[model samples]
Target: MSERTVIPFGPQHPVLPEPIHLDLVMEDERVVQAIPQLGFIHRGLERLVKTRDYMHFVYVTERICGICSFGHSYGYSQTIERLMGIEVPMRAEYLRVIWFELSRIHSHLLWMGLAADSFGYENLFYQCWRLRERVLDIFEKTTGGRVILSACNVGGVNYDIDNSELAGISQIIQKLKRDAKPLIKALVKDRSIKDRLVGSGYLSQEDAVKLSIVGPFARASGVEEDIRMFGVGGYGELAEFKPQTSTQGDNYARVAVRCNELLQSCDIICEMIDKIPDGPICEKPKGNPPEAQGIGRVEQPRGEVVYYVKGNGTRFLERFRIRTPTSQNVAGMVQLLQGCELSEVPLNILTIDPCISCTER
Candidate 1:
């Protein structure tokens, strides 16, 4: 009989950028069970709603997760807009979609780079990030920040990209589309990559639904559910919007799903540029928020993010809640870790793209 033993996975690991600990219970080289330990970097940002006014609280929300900062800001603003009954202009809604899609592309690129680094492909990692820099350059040229975009607000966006700037953005995305193909080709065709990821960490479609998994992880398992399909935040304008999916539900499938989504995001951005309307970007709120409740749901790069708010007819809110995708996907992560070779543990964890910042927040 093989001896059972436990090993600590993280809180600090060379492969991970964020702090997430896992207790792996193993028999020989195969993991039998895994227990996740969170709460390493909780910032208490949700509770700050009681102190910051609705207008100012958006900044706090933006800090919840650097990779998905705009999603948080937009979700909070959407909730506040609903509570205060503010109608944002059509142009702003389209602009939000553009930025959101850009964020998704950059996020997936970052994840691909990190995953490469996790498996010791340093050159591939640099190449992936070099491609990602172009996306950040687009953000800097438009939003003045690469990671944390503070442009989203309660009524609408804080800044506007002129038609000429939008054209430049469209051109940049075209170039990005062309430039990304080679790196993606490398990721897909590399034999070492396949040997490491293919057939490892399988999560069947049935188990995915049973675990209530969200985001790319779920989509990779053949779950075609994406909140963006609801057409919120001007996603409806892109009538051709479809969720990227893969049937294998393994680490390789997750990478392929994200890579396909990156291409899809580029297309979505270009389409939004072509179809965006001309109108005011924002509107002033009429009055103080009444005692009311509001909810905002958005599809972040990681997955679905939900924000709930309650107003008390004052600057300070009564309650605020955030349901981040990583937090919801913890069970799914553990499930993927079980019954896998211990050496594949880091790759399995990376497949979920765990954002501990969002989880602990």
Candidate 2:
């Protein structure tokens, strides 16, 4: 019998941008079990609801995750708006979808770069990020911030784009689609990329459902559960929207699912621009929120993010709660970690595309 050995990985690993520590129990070179740990970066941001007023809390929510910053802000604002019975304008709703899809595209690009780096494909990593910078430029042009956009508010959006600007944005997206094709081809068809990702970290469809996985991770496992179909924002107008999924449930499937969604995001963005209504961008709230509670859900780049707000008819909210995608997907990550070679541990964890800051929040 082989002697069991324990190895501590990360919280400061080179491949992972955020800190996540996993204690791997190994039998020789094979990982027998993975014990995940947290709290290295917890900031108790959730508890800030007690101090920050409901209106100012949107900024705090945006800081939860840089990659999903707008999603968090939108979710929180939506919750407050619902509680206050404030209806956002039609144009604002369409604008929300436009920026949200742009955020998704950039996030997927960032993850693709990181995934490439995890497998030691340095050139591929650079290429992926070089393409991602264009997405960031779009964010800067529209929202005035690259990562954390404060444009989304309780009643509607803080910014607006003219029809001509929206058209220009569409043209830019078309160019991005054309420019990004070569890198996408390299990632999908390159022999070495497939060799590393094809069969690694296999998550069965049944296992994914049992674990309550979300986002591309669940989609990759053939469980169709995209919250966008709920028509929370401008998605109701996007009748042609379809959730991307694959049956393989391996690392490759996850990558493919995200890549396909990137294309879908581009389409969604263009559609939103074309169909956006011309009107007031925001509605002024009438009064303070009454004593009530509401929940807001948005399909983030990661997955479904739930924001719960309880109002006491005061400036400060009585309670605020957030259910981030990474928090829900951790169980699935642990399940995939076990029974893989020790060397494959990082790649398996990376497949989940974890944002520890969001999880630890």
In the order shown, the candidates' Cα RMSDs to the true structure are 1.0, 1.0
Residues 1-361 of candidate 2 have per-residue lDDT tens digits of 7999999998898877999899999999988888989888899898999899777888999999899998898888888888898889999999999998999999999999999999999998999899899989988998899998998988899999989999999999998888778888888889999998999899999998998899999999999999898787678889686899999999999989998999899989989998999999998777666798898888888887888888888788888888888998999999998899887888888889998898888
- Prediction 2 TM-score vs. true: 0.98
Report lDDT (CA) for all predictions. Answer: 0.90, 0.89
Q: Give the worst 10-residue stretch by lDDT in candidate 1.
A: 281-290
Following a full C-alpha superposition, what root-mean-square deviation does model 1 have from the true structure?
1.0
Global CA lDDT computed for model 1? 0.90
**Per-residue lDDT for 1-361 in model 1, tens only?**
7899999988999878999889999999999999988888988888888988878888998898898988888888888888887888999999999998898998999999999999899998998899889988988888899888898988899999999999899999999999999888877779999988899999999999998899999999999989999987688788687899999999999999999999999999999999988989988776667898888899999999888888899988999998889988889989988899888988888989999998878
Model 1 CA lDDT for position 185: 83
Lowest lDDT sum, 10 consecutive residues, model 2, at 284-293
lDDT for 191 in candidate 1 is 94
